[model samples]
Target: MIFTRKRQPLNKLTIAHAAYTLQKEVKWLGITLNPTLSPNLHLRMVKTKTNNTIKQLTQIIQPTFGLCQREARILIVGVMMTKILHGSIIWYTNKNRNTVRKKLTGRLFQAVQLSTGMMKQPPLPCLELYGGIRDITKQNIRLAHNYLHTKLAALIDDGHRTLIWKDLTVPQPIHPSPLNNLIEKNTLLQQHFTRTETLSPFPVPPWCHRGSWKENKSGLALRNLELTWRAPKG
Candidate 1:
């Protein structure tokens, strides 16, 4: 696909003695790339897939049948959400595009409603609140922020980091990338380094022993003490 905002004629080209034509859109690495680089097509495809999945899930999930509320919530989070937000880091932005956001959220809210066994009359905020789901826009921003942080952490050279930082944080009057929008929305991201750094090292250590700790008195006592210390205080 030829990515550009200007009007241009599609010209055929020959590669390795084979003639090729320009495509209106091309799917690469699961993301749809169009001539204008707009995410509308990709979002539409995702919406269709999500709707189909929801339809199939409705068969097994009911008000009081196949799946309980807790199981429904798990499925929504683990399956539906993962599918909906699949390449969101590349396409999502919390800008002034309410039309796109509304369409996406409306479809997503259906899954939440199904999980919660509620009708469609509830507002988005109410649906998200009772459904125990995060807003799509917020989640996209979070994923972008995490992506940025991870990228920054991986860069060892200060010069490379500075270049990347300036490129992403620099103000663009005309058009801004998703990362730029994220930085604009959260001023804290403008900092050279994130205040809250998260690390996911290789072979993550287990939080506790493998076996049943309740069998050992000392382990049980330690667990209770830890739980008490971590518990919310009144």
Candidate 2:
């Protein structure tokens, strides 16, 4: 069975004298996978789920029984945001995000405004800054970073070392590519391996530095270290 964007008829698969046809999309473990492996359907599902949660939160937070702004902020951070972003990093892609970015951002803006007790939705940036909430893009990146960090840590662990090495192995080039050879010939690629830049002897001090008796006790003070010019003896 085959799935395609075109309307062409597809051949049927027969098993035990029974015929089965291809599907345009398949749902597995709550994620929709299409033939192209495109994330459009996944993004749509995420948007739908997020919008539903936002709607529910809005209804539950009516003035009469609504939480105060502070409590609402906590709820937004702890619950609503979590629900909206669940499994986001796994299927997130720039193309899918570009397709639904505005709608998703608008929904997020509305959710934040409602939760924070704002009279009206502010500009997205203002909502992010003044409302003390990260924009959707940053939040998505953060989730991806944290998830990758944890997965990498596990992969590098002794029990999974082999798995890590296996996964990290690069696939062999099936067919030689003229473009790849051309790219490898570039001077920049050679320069990358030849560049030699030694680390500076004295870099910027740590954020909190314990000082000597002559220096300030508070670690907040920036250390003033200087090197005087000297001429070599002839």
Name the top TM-score candidate.
Answer: 2
Backbone clash total, candidate 1? 0
Candidate 1 wrongly placed segments (more than 4 Å): 1-51, 54-67, 78-97, 120-234
Q: List the residue pairs that clash in candidate 1.
A: none
Each candidate: RMSD to true structure? 21.1, 24.4
TM-score of 1: 0.24
lDDT (10s digit) by residue, model 2, range 2-60? 22323325556443334545466543223344655445665576667766666665655
lDDT score at residue 231, model 1, on the 0-100 scale: 12
Whole-model lDDT, candidate 1? 0.34
lDDT of 2 at 10: 50
What C-alpha lDDT does candidate 2 achieve relative to the native structure?
A: 0.34
- Assess the local accuracy of residue 69 in candidate 1 as a C-alpha lDDT between 0 and 100: 35
User: How many pairs of residues collide in each model?
Assistant: 0, 0
Give lDDT tens digits, candidate 1, residues 142-222.
Answer: 444344333333431221111100112333333232122222333333433422211121121111112111111211111
